[model samples]
Target: MYPINTISKGGLALVLAAAALGVPLAAAEPDDGELWAGAESRIQRHRMADAVVVVRDALGRPVEGAEVRIEQKTHAFLFGCNIFLWGRLPDAGMERAYRERFAALLNYATLPFYWGSYERRRGEPRHEETERVARWCQQQGIVTKGHPLAWNNADPPWLPDDLDEIRRLQMERIEDCVRRFTGLIDRWDVVNEVTHFDRPQFVTIRAPKHSAMWERVGQIEFARQCFRHARAAGPHATLIINDYRTDAACERVIEQLVDENGRRLYDVIGIQSHMHGGVWSNAKIWEVCQRFARFGVPLHFTETTILSGQQGRGRPRSTPWRSTPEGEARQAREVVRFYTMLFSHPAVEAITWWDLSDYRAWKGAPAGLVREDMSPKPAYQRLMDLVRGKWWTKLSLQTDQQGQGRLRGFLGDYAVTVTAPGKAPVAKDFSLARRQTNRWQIVLP
Candidate 1:
């Protein structure tokens, strides 16, 4: 048997006792449609306090639909995917093998609208591929997040040549892309990486093709303009200003954005968490996340991955993290540790993998949950266990105040009951799992 990490005696007891209870556990139900409608419809309705609280009882069951004791909510997890070049370009054939992998892993698919990739040639956008992916994602009941509608890397060759054409062309591209994928995507990242602290802003990396839109338009103004344009073309899309490095400056810019008077440039505060320098201590991740929680904008752990055993720095880098079985096993254990840690965080809404497989992963790190062959890795199974296998279960609550029982938990189907309160106790089951578009539902009252 593979060695599992150590846990507290109490936690270990929860696991062992549950395993011993093995008496034909109920098969976890697949999600149903119209279930998350309340949540989805409210996406554009509220820009602030966009999180939910998670709680549990003595029993180790994931409870759902618990009343918010606190006005502030911290949605346990809002699942997502980040469209990186490694996920798309050239070796996408490898992606074809793992279609089911992505379909199951994400509730939202984030498409990066790099100015160069979207409109490699003037007046010619990658409309075919964009529509193809967007439509498919919608059919699968997956909400869409269009990344970086405005970015420094978004400049076309013609854009940098003439300053006079920057605003006109930038606006035109934004309009075209937004219109092209209208209504299909629910959220759009208006800007990405605007703050430059220790690292350079996008313009520095893109070089000679830099723009006045980045330097002169001002990050906030650019974000506002992009959000306005995106809204004009695609109504009801949540706008976001996503940044990588979580420094004080980044926090300031995000705060400036969410708190602005007339222009609330961003709806969701997108934060990236690609921790390749070994697993980050729990405290570190929490510290960064808590800051975003202050702004009251729902937080999305936008683009994230933990390398198994790679060596590289930033965008242009090298080495695969897991080339052997031991390495692969280590990668798997890390995935569980990282996921369990993040899932427990209140502020983190979503955690997206840059790629589903290493076939075309940026700098080729074994960061994917599965292998290129579509085989399940330890990481994949752990995710399946959480995301699919045990999405819903029965929970027990010991009564607290006023003869009423109170407990905290996740968003999913749950059955709760009292064992020894009044004469003979009572039980209540709340089927709260989000309904799926593909499945049929018959409500039982």
Candidate 2:
């Protein structure tokens, strides 16, 4: 078998040459059925952990045969969607539906930080609006992430002509945003799409000024500066390097994002899987995870899109695209498979859907989990089944002679209730985490 490092470092040509000379290459890609056959086992092995709950009386004696109830309160794994329409829906009813549906299903929310729209003016940066959204997410017990602290997707119209000034302002913005929302928003996509920083499409139309600044500073330095600024401002923040490309170019960018000590500066590696054209095969999804898992940091599927309507063909159409019954069914099935594969991979930490609703979805593609009327689609319902039903943990157990009740469950926050025959039931909360000991001790009054 070819070493993964060898194949990643431009050694594919050697494999091809060997194949032509009657030499066998690495193992063939596994079929879909074969790949999925091990998914449940993988999820159990990697995502679930064992815990011991010990119940004691006020006199420090074992409370034998105490009933212990465990119910998962939240997932340690982040299942999320971008909340661009948090309160921007057309009407109050739609807005309520959006909030209710999002909170019911997801525990993580990605807030937009696109530079052009976020800060239309030089001194103003929409802090109040972003705070409002972040506050709402916090109230709903959701984790909030700011996206694309530095990207050339769109440049603020007031961006200065000078490259030096532009660079200064960009770095300042990163530091300011990270500092200002230090606790409310702790995770950020520090540098987005750096591999395609100067793509022709962006340079010519959408972000000419920002593209020019990126070219002047060089990609690696530009990314390094942005990450450094963010780290300086929010030292404990989770910084990510995000890109849509999953090829060697993206890998090269990640390899260079290190500090003077050669330590990785970013906390997470963000991969964008915008499957507007079609869903990726199971093998490809597994391959991407395998390739990036070498980096040692967690992987976040940051921007994922699977269309529930006919994909755009030839050129963009002016009419709105609507989700179909057949397409929604297909999307639901594909979403389950996609999420199952990613969740089973130990390296992947989070998956964020691109849009929450079909209304004003990116490029008007029917990629949301809900339809335009703010109703849940099949994809949404099926995902809810997996994330909350099959994957969630709820169990009842009785304490043994040693006052300890042992059980295995998916990692998350749990509410534990201990009830003894003649004593009032005692309630407490605890978290099951891979990094911490899962043993808990509860004292009954």
lDDT per residue (tens digit) for residues 302-337 in model 1: 887765455345433453345457656776776665
- TM-scores, in order shown? 0.67, 0.94
lDDT of 1: 0.56
Give the per-residue lDDT digits (tens) of candidate 2, residues 369-411.
9999989999999999999999999999999999999999999
Candidate 1 to truth, TM? 0.67
Which candidate wins on lDDT?
2
lDDT scores for all predictions? 0.56, 0.88
Off by over 4 Å in 2: 1-6, 10-29, 312-319
Give the Cα error of residue 41 in candidate 1, in Å.
Answer: 28
Model 2, clash count?
0
Clashing pairs in 2: none
